[model samples]
Target: MSKKQHRGWGVGEQAEQHYLVEPRHLAGGGDVRHVSEFLRAAGWTDQSRTGGPLVFDSPARTVHVAYNPFVRPGGWTITGKANDHEPEWNVTFNPQTPVEIVAGFTDALTKSRSAHAPNPWAPLRQHGWETERAQHFTAVSPDRNAWLQFHQTGEGQAHWWAGARTEHGRTWDAVLTPSTPMHLIEAFSAALADPQPVMRPRGNIPPSRWIRTTSVSVRPSELGAWQQARISAARAATWARNSWASSSPRTHTPTPRPYAAAAGAVRTGR
Candidate 1:
């Protein structure tokens, strides 16, 4: 009989692999009780409750929820592992995390574990952003004047951009990251619906207010013609101005030339 070689394989190694396979972070304000309830509802076993951090165990994972003294306004750090492994998965929730987002994370985590797949964007999708591609999505406000875009980073983090065009043709834009609270996104969406100007991040300029003015919405196919008409009008105005500027009193102001006729040519598609 051949002697069997003994290679040391242990629980710690399995735990490390499990954690490394799917790591996620969710940060903002949240309630511990809500988190605890969520864990219980997901069927995680209560392991240790006697001190430092509350512990929960799953068939192949361990979780710890503890108060983070270093975070302001008091926050909790939730960590997960395959089973007491090194380099555990961590997510922090601060005071700014809404209750709905906390619940959404729990649902996403549960789905990920059972499906054997990672879906970190579940919460965002639930909030009405339509996915365009993997980790990319766009949300347009009802008025069509404002839009929000989300782009996921290589590390599975998220980047956000919000833009709005005012009635006067001025544009406002902002770039934000996951570290910013979700409430800000909601606020931006609301501001886009109304006429109020959104404050830009870097400048001392005042907010851009929209004026109720006459506007025209041109179709993409008709844009060229509209542009040509505007160009003709500009040229006519320049010619009239130059003619008047170069003329003496004897010129009689060029007999009030037909400037509108030239502009009307393009508008009439002639």
Candidate 2:
């Protein structure tokens, strides 16, 4: 889809094959539930309980993810604290932010990485977004309601950070600090800027909100398929993370050089 918002209203294709993934918030609406589910499956420590914020910490305690209904009912708080003091990088998904979209960020986060740096702009450029500086490197979405800025304007602003934002009643935003991993942020950018049309019951697109939407319909079966695909993907990612963990190289401590001249010790045979 050339534009972020489509032209009309309709049901979304529920099947995995027919899916054109986009932020669920953009589609109709979304929640962090699925993201939390995936994180648990991927081995994150879950500290949340019934009717409270959704919270999880990366196994090493370096990263934290929170979906708070108390503080920011519509936002998600994610931070990386490798030093165990200050955050290396922080990405916050503002209220109304789609969990699925944010999942794109987490999806890339939990997986392994390559040697090259991430290019957050590739996806947007491919979608025909132009790049410029509004006091920072930024890209505007097709409908002009959203933005991707290289430097966030809030708390973690000084670091090598970037952000994604949206306006309107269902507005949402994201920010990353300088110390944040570039590769991970790249995944976030790609997810936000994806051009494929995602299925939405069409929130923010009807007459009241006045946003464009693609003409489409959803069948009951397809919806089931879509849900299935999402669950399957989550499980697969969990397995991949576990496999990676188990296969990671381990450091071996060499025995102290055989105690030289042990006092009154018999010479040991090799």
Best by lDDT: 2
Cα lDDT of model 1 overall?
0.38
Best by TM-score: 2
lDDT of 2: 0.58
For residues 100-147, write the lDDT of model 2, one tens digit per residue. Answer: 568778866566675576787887788767788766777777666566
Give the clash count for model 2. 13
Sequence-dependent TM-score of model 1: 0.31
Worst 10 residues of 2 by lDDT: 254-263
All candidates' lDDT scores? 0.38, 0.58
Q: What does candidate 2 score on TM?
A: 0.68
Poorest 10 consecutive residues by lDDT, candidate 1:
15-24
For model 1, the stretches where C-alpha displacement exceeds 4 angstroms are: 1-31, 41-61, 67-73, 82-88, 107-127, 130-270
What are the clash counts of all predictions, listed in order? 5, 13
Candidates' TM-scores? Answer: 0.31, 0.68
